[model samples]
Target: MPARNEAGNLPALVDEIAAALASRGPFEAIVVDDGSNDATPKVLAELKRTRPWLIPLRHAVSCGQSAAIRTGVRAATAPVVATLDGDGQNDPTFLPAALDALAAGGARVGLVAGQRLGRKDTGFKKIQSRIANAVRGRVLGDGTRDTGCGLKAFRRDVFLALPYFDALHRFLPALVRREGFEVGLIDVVDRPRQAGVSNYGLWDRLWVGILDLYGVWWLIRRRRQVPEVTEL
Candidate 1:
């Protein structure tokens, strides 16, 4: 999970992840500290001592959410990686379901994205998201209603193959589809944040993604043919 200055929420969120996935099998939770000025780094350090599954990474300067996620995913040792907002809004319990969905679809499903139900944001924020989702879905035809939902599961290799960008996380479905892989969707219930104010604003939510959207559209339209290979 990518987090900035979310010191108050990390402990509980990490614990929840442990509770949700510990019994399933071996897994690691990589929390990227994106140049947080708060006690986020310290808290992660303290938590690391006890929870071997918790892997903490830090950036000296903030490079935004997409970069943070890239950092964590790169460091992850697992073949399949599940991601969610570091804030407490996303429930960790859904991780198994997402992973299952992705596994069920096998190699064809490169991504299993979460679509939020009953968003907890303010009315204006909801409106902005609706407008953004509509525009993005119509233009990209990604067939997803909530690309902004942070909960997602995919193969680590598949994720690394995509072209990196500032807002790559927001256009994952479209880009995954562009790579000739199907995208799966699961309905996730949203929750109000447990602590700290939201770091994203109007620009971060809607306007900033416009250019990235177009770039993804171009990439999709210009997709190269993947040749079938038969080696005797």
Candidate 2:
């Protein structure tokens, strides 16, 4: 989890996710501090002291969400990696379901993305996301309905193969598909933010997404195509 200025939500979010993971099976949570200017560091330190599973990585300067995610993934010790928004909107209970989907879908499924069934966000934000998803689906042809949904899981190697960018987190399905791996989507419930404020607004994300979409499109066009080779 890449957390920034989430002091109010960190404690509950950490506890709930930890309990949920414990209920299903064994898992570890890595809390990456993206240079938070709030009490998030103190809260994370406290949680780490109490919970052995929690690994905390602190950034001296804010490097945005994508960088934080990359840092966390690199520090992960598990073969399978899962990510959830630190804003407390994503339910950690659905993690098992995502894992099961990947297992049932087989090894070809490189990434399992969660599609938020019922989102709890402001009207403008929802509308913007719908527009972005539609445009992205048409262009990327990734067959993913909700790319912005934060809850997702994938093989560590598959994730490492993708080209990392500033907003690559939002277009993970497309990136995974580029590596000739299948992408799976599962419906996950979204909840209202438990505490703190959302850092993103409609316009900010919309403009940034438009630029990123074009960049990804160019990457797809330039993708190398090679024929299969067999060894004797």
Candidate 3:
């Protein structure tokens, strides 16, 4: 998980996620610090010293969540990668279930996105998300209900193949679909924020999302399709 200034929530979030994954056996938790100005790096370093499973990476400057995600993905040593927001709003318990869905191989699904049920965001934020989701669904036709939900899992190879851009993290379903992979949706629990303020606002996301939507659309249209050759 890529975390930025998430010092207050990191301890609990890491602990809960670790405990949840313990039931399924070993899994490494890569915590990438996205140039956090707060004590996030200190906390991660301390944790890493004791917990070998907790790997830590730090960016010299603050990058957007998308960049942080790319860093973490590159550092991932596992076949399957799961991502969740650092704010602790996404439930870790649903991770194993998302992995199970991916393993089922329903139509070569490349990404499994968790749909946040009963979101706990402010009314304004929720309204903005609803509008954005409606627009994205109409434009992309990716069949994903909640692309904004942070909890997601997919094959590591599939994730590394996608083009990188700022805020492109929100369009994973559509991008993965363009690669001829199906997207699976699963319902996940949402929780109220326990610490720190949200990094996004309504107007900023709205304006940026509009531009990103068009950019993704053009990329999708211009994408080249090549047949896979098994034996020459």
Candidate 4:
């Protein structure tokens, strides 16, 4: 989970995740605290004492969400990694199902992404997302509708091999496909945030996203096919 100033939401989200994944055997929940100024560090400290599965990491200064996600993925001990927003808007119950979907698709499925239904964002935000998604779809043609949804499951090695950038989290499907793997989608019901306001703004993503989109498009066009390797 990539979290910034999400202190109010972490405890409940952690508990919910534990409950949801308890039957799935052992797993680690890596919460990357992206330089939160609030009581976030303290809360994580407290949560850590009780929950061994909680792997709390902190950035010395605030990096964006993509950086945080990259940090968690790099540190992951599991071969498959699942991500969700740390603000409690993303339901933890969907993680197992997403992982299952990825597994069902076999080794070629590099990413299983969540498509949010009934978004709880303000009308303006939802409109902005719709416009962004449409533009991205036309430009990259990654066959994904809601790339902004935070819930995702993928192979840790595949994720680490992808080109990293500021907004890489939002472009996973395109990049994963560029690496010659299939993408899977699952419908996820959105929920209102448990606490705190949104950390992102229209300006923060708009211009950068355009540049990133073109970059990904170029990468897709210039890519070479993956070689089939057979060794003696």
Candidate 5:
């Protein structure tokens, strides 16, 4: 999980995750604290002492959520990586199902993104997301409904191979497709923030994404289509 000052929500979210997937298999939680000014690091330390499966990684200064996720995925030993926001809005109850879906989809499926069914964001925030998603879908043709959903499961190697960027997380469906892999989708009921303030809002998110949308579109068009090779 990529966290920035999410101390208030971590404890309960951690417990929920443990309860949800403890029996499934050997799974680990890598909480990347992105230079939080709150008690996030200390809280992670305390949790680590008790939870062996919890891996706590920290950033000296905030490097944004995408960098934090990349750091955690790089440090992970698991074949598949699951990431959710640290603010407790992503319900841990849906993780096992996502893992199962990814597993069943087999190797060709590089990403299984959670589509938020009922968003709990403010009206303006939802509107911004709707506009963004509509534009992205029309441009990229990624066939994903809710790319903004934090709950996502993907192969570790696939994620590592994809081009990394500051806002790359929101473009996974398109990038994974660019890597010759199919994307899977699952519907998850959105939950309201359990605690702490939201780090994102309308204008801050919208303005930056306009350029990124076009950039991704360019990438799609410029891709070199590799022909099938047959060797003697």
Candidate 6:
């Protein structure tokens, strides 16, 4: 999970994820403490002692959510990786289903994006997301309704190969499709934050997200074609 100053939310969130994933199979929960100023580091440190499956990574300075995600993925030892928001809004209960979707989608499927069914955010946040999704769809044509949802599962290699950007997390569906892969979605019920304040501001990212959308559109247009070949 990518987190900045989310100490109030991390410990319980981690435990909840572990409990949810317990009966399913082996899973490690990695928390990327993205230069948090609070007691986040201390909390993670304590959790590590009890939850050995928990992997802790620290960034010297806050590099945004995208950077933190990239860092965690790079350090991930699993073939498939699952990402959750540090704020505990994205339900961990949906992770196993997402994993199943990836497996059932066959090898060509590179991503399983979680689409929030009934989002628990405020009216303003919901409207901003709706508008953003519409604009992004029209521009990039990624065919995903909710790319901003934090719950996602995908092959680690597929993510590592994609071009890195500050807001890459928001455009994952389009990027995954651009790499000759399919992206699947599963509906999930969103939850309100367990504690603390939200670090993200829709207005702060509105302009940058627009630019990123257009950049991705150009990328799709310029994407190179490869010919099928066999060894002679």
Find the candidate with the highest TM-score and give its number: 4
List, residue by residue over 1-232, the lDDT tens digit for candidate 3. 8788899989999988898799887899988899999999998888888788998899999888999999998999998999999999998999989989998975488999999999999998888788889999999888887898989999999999998899978999999989988898899989998998888887767778899999999999997893465986
| Candidate-wise lDDT, in order | 0.93, 0.89, 0.90, 0.94, 0.91, 0.91
In the predicted model 1, the residue pairs found to clash are none
Clashes of each: 0, 0, 0, 0, 0, 0
In model 3, residue pairs whose N, Cα or C atoms come closer than 3 Å (at least 3 residues apart or on different chains), thus clashing, are none
Ten contiguous residues minimizing lDDT sum, candidate 6: 220-229
Candidate 2 — which residues are off by over 4 angstroms? 23-25, 226-231
lDDT of 1 by residue, 1-232 (tens): 9999999999999999999898888889999999999999999999999999899999999999999999999999989999999888999999899999999999899999999999999999999999999999999999999998999999999899999989899999998888888999999999999889898999655555787788899998899875566999
The residue-by-residue lDDT of candidate 4 on 1-232, one tens digit each, is 9999999999999999999899999999999999999999999999999999999999999999999999999999999999999989899999889999999999889999999999999999999999999999999999999999999999999999998888999899999999999999999999999799899999988898899889989988998887667998
Query: Distance from true position, residue 22, model 3, in Å?
Result: 0.7
The regions of model 4 sitting more than 4 angstroms off are none
TM-score of each prediction: 0.97, 0.95, 0.96, 0.98, 0.96, 0.96
Best candidate, lDDT-wise?
Answer: 4
Candidate number with the higher lDDT (3 or 5): 5
lDDT of 1: 0.93
Backbone clash pairs for candidate 6 read none
Please give the range of 10 consecutive residues that has the lowest summed lDDT in model 1.
203-212
Candidate 5: worst 10 consecutive residues by lDDT? 220-229
